[model samples]
Target: MSEAVISLSNAFIYQKENLILSDVNFSINKGEFVYLIGKTGSGKSSLLKTLYADLWLEKGHGKVAGFELENIKYKEIPFLRRKIGIIFQDFQLLPDRNVLQNLRFFMEAMGWDDKMKIDDRIMEVLELVGLPDVLKKHPHQLSGGEQQRIAIARALLNHPEILLADEPTGNLDPEKSIEILKLFFKINEVSDTAVLMATHELGLIERFPRRTLYCDGGIINDLTGNS
Candidate 1:
C-alpha cells in the first residue's frame, strides 16, 4: 500500500474571518500525482496554503509529510515546511544571483553544513530536472520555462516528501505548460514524491489525467473516489 503524504479530515480553511473551504477531506498517497482543479477563488490555493501552514487550520484535522496541522505550534512551522516543497505561479528566483548561487543560498538556509554535500545535491537536482549546465545563468538570462525549471530544481533540492504546487504552469504557454507538467510527472515517477498541483487549466487535466479533486462552492469533491 502507498503511504499517505497528505490528509485532511473535516478541515475548514479560512482567511481571517472568512471561510474559504469547508469540511475538506482527502488523502494523497506517496508517489501519487493528483490534480487539484477548480475555478479562480474556488479555494484551491487556500487549501494548499493551509496544508503548507501558510494559513492556519481553523478547524478539524490535517496532516502533511508526517506533520500534524490541527495543533501545529508557531515555532514548529519551519520544521514542518522543511519536509515539504512549495512551488508558485511566479518563478521567485533572486535577480542578482546566478542559478547555482541561488540554490546554494537556499541550501545554506535549509541548514546544509557541508559545501561538498551541497554542491553534489545541486548537481543532482539540476540533472533531475534535465538541465545540468544552466547553473551559471541568471534568472533574466533564462526563458520562462527555464526559470520554472530552476524553481522545480530548487524545490527538489531538499528532497521533500511532497510538492505543493499552486498554478505552477499558469504563467507558461500551452507547449511550455505541457513540458512543465511532464517534468512534474517525471519527478513523481522517478523520485516517488507525491504532488498536489493546483491549477484551473482543465485542458492540462484532460491531457494528463490523474485522479482529480474539484473545488467549488467551499467544497472539495474527489472525482475519482475509491480508485
Candidate 2:
C-alpha cells in the first residue's frame, strides 16, 4: 500500500454554490500525527470533509486510504469510511443507548455479523481508550473526558488506518482537554494510526507540536513544507 495515507493535489473545495477553498494540496503519511489549525469558518473542516468523501472533490485530484476521490461513486463512500475513523466536536452518541449498544449499532451497520467477534472488538477498543469497564454507562453518566474517551473508542472500533478528529476537545475544560490530548497521543503511539486532528486550541498545540496545516484565505497551507 502507498505510504501516503491521504493525498490531495490541485484540489478545489466547494460548499454548494460558493467555492470554499481552492488550490489545496497536502499528503499525510502512514503513522503520522498532524494538527490542523485555523479560525472558525476557515477551510479546515472543508478540507477534512473532502478527504473523508463527506463532500465531493468537485475539481482536481484526491485519494484517501487507497480510494480515488475523482471517480468515487456514492455506493463506495461507506467502504472508504471503513478505512478511516471520524470524530466530531460533539460527542454525537446515541443519547438513549448505553455504551455497549452504541458501539454495537455501529458494528452492525459496518456489516459485522458474528456476535462473538463484535463483543470482543468492543472490549478491545474500550480498553484502548481506557474505558473497558463502562459498557453499561450512558453518555450522560460519564464526565466530559470519559464521554470523549468513549467517542474515541467508538472511532477505533474499525481499527482504521487514519483517524480524522474535528475539534475533539472543543467541549472540554483545560484539564480535560489535556487528558484527551494525552489519550490521542497514546493512541498514535500504541497503534501507529495516522491522525489528522482539526483543532483551535493553541495551548495544546504549543505543548505538543507536530506538523501542522493552516487554513486561511480559502487555502490550506502546510506549515511543515514550502508554502
Pick by TM-score: which candidate is best? 1
Error of model 2, residue 225, in angstroms: 1.9
Q: How accurate locally is residue 172 in candidate 2, as Cα lDDT from 0 to 100?
A: 97
Model 2 per-residue lDDT at 183? 89
Please report how far candidate 2 places residue 43 from its true position, in Å: 1.1
Structural similarity to truth (TM-score) of each candidate: 0.98, 0.97
Backbone clashes, candidate 2: 0
Write out the backbone clash pairs for model 1: none
lDDT (Cα, 0-100) at 31 in candidate 1: 92
**What is the alpha-carbon lDDT for the whole of candidate 1?**
0.93
Local distance difference test values of all predictions, in order: 0.93, 0.91
Q: Write the per-residue lDDT of candidate 1 for residues 1-227, one digit (tens) a residue.
A: 88898989999999999999988889999999999999999999989889989899989999888889989999989888888989999989999999999999999998999999999999999999889999899999999999999999999999999999999999999999999999999999999999999999999998778999999999999998843
